[model samples]
Target: MMYTQEQNREVEKVMKAFADYIRDTQHFDLLWSDKVGYVFLDGISEEHDDFCMAPIILRDGETLCEEIIYHIACDVMEEKGKSHDLRLCGPVEREEIQKRLLPYLRQLPEYEHLVEGLFEK
Candidate 1:
């Protein structure tokens, strides 16, 4: 089903927040595709063909999108910081994201479930 207006607004919120975060810290621009639930044309990674925020946007809802944004923050831009790290080298792996960065991000409101169901050991 197509996203309702309210849900679309949530997507915009998440996209804007993420774009702003990218601009402020990375000094670059981000392009997002709602149809595909991925961010591309990032001015950061020369090696970066592209990056996908996990779980898809419309299908996954904004809460998870927010978590995915934080996931990109911690994995792609922050910790890895333009590297060949496995996290950025390919499509985001939920387990890898949860394992490598969730503990640090879990305190943040949006990332509280960064590992919830997926990372249980």
Candidate 2:
């Protein structure tokens, strides 16, 4: 999923907007990943929780990958209660998430067609 120049610009814009949103809303800095060619939103509050946006030229927006840790219910495990369960999800449709960030993305041009025809299939 290589990013075109324009696509990368959009990604940079969105990353800036999202980072700003988080900083303003949460009053903290996100622990960004140091990977040279990847965009990641690594939360500092907890380890192993990250939001990665991989650039895909086919779509105007990047593909999202979320890593989260879910705690097992008390009834599910007693000895393992303190253990962690990590779930890696997505490569999901950007449209499914773009809606929630509409307020931010809407500011960009082509907001209406940003996610058009942007599925892996």
Candidate 3:
């Protein structure tokens, strides 16, 4: 799917914000509950299910929550969804995510190596 120029800009902005957040903490907890089909970061736990484990992705998700960036981007896209456009959904394809997200993350030194293994072969 091709994103509009504005959509691309928003995605970049949100990803940069997340990168800044991670840089500040040097740690993040991303949790997903298959039972609830809910993926969220640390603070939203109270509103959701018991997300005990990190998401299992093609990579070692426990250490690299790169999927979280995609999920959060999907949410942002969904909010910006137009009446004429398809509603953005969860589990955005790994390739699509890597295309849209990785470049911004790679710009940050700390995230350069961390996101390397996030994609599947």
Query: What local lDDT does model 2 show for residue 47?
Result: 43
lDDT of 2 by residue, 35-79 (tens): 534443433343435434432222233432111101111112233
For candidate 1, write residues 1-121 as lDDT tens digits: 3566766665565555454454564423434464655343333444545443333334333453544445454454345455533334434454555555444344344535544533332
| lDDT against the true structure, each candidate | 0.46, 0.36, 0.42
Which of the two, 1 or 2, has more TM-score?
1
How well does candidate 3 match the true structure in TM-score terms? Answer: 0.29
Question: Is candidate 1 or 3 superior in lDDT?
Answer: 1
Q: Report the C-alpha displacement of residue 98, candidate 3, in angstroms.
A: 1.6
Rank by lDDT, descending?
1, 3, 2
Give the worst 10-residue stretch by lDDT in candidate 1: 52-61
Error of 2 at 109 (Å): 6.1
lDDT of 3 by residue, 1-121 (tens): 2445654454344345466544443123433354542233443254356444454322232223454553444434544452212232324443454556555565544544433443321
Q: Model 3 clash pairs?
A: none
Quote the lDDT for 34 in model 3: 47
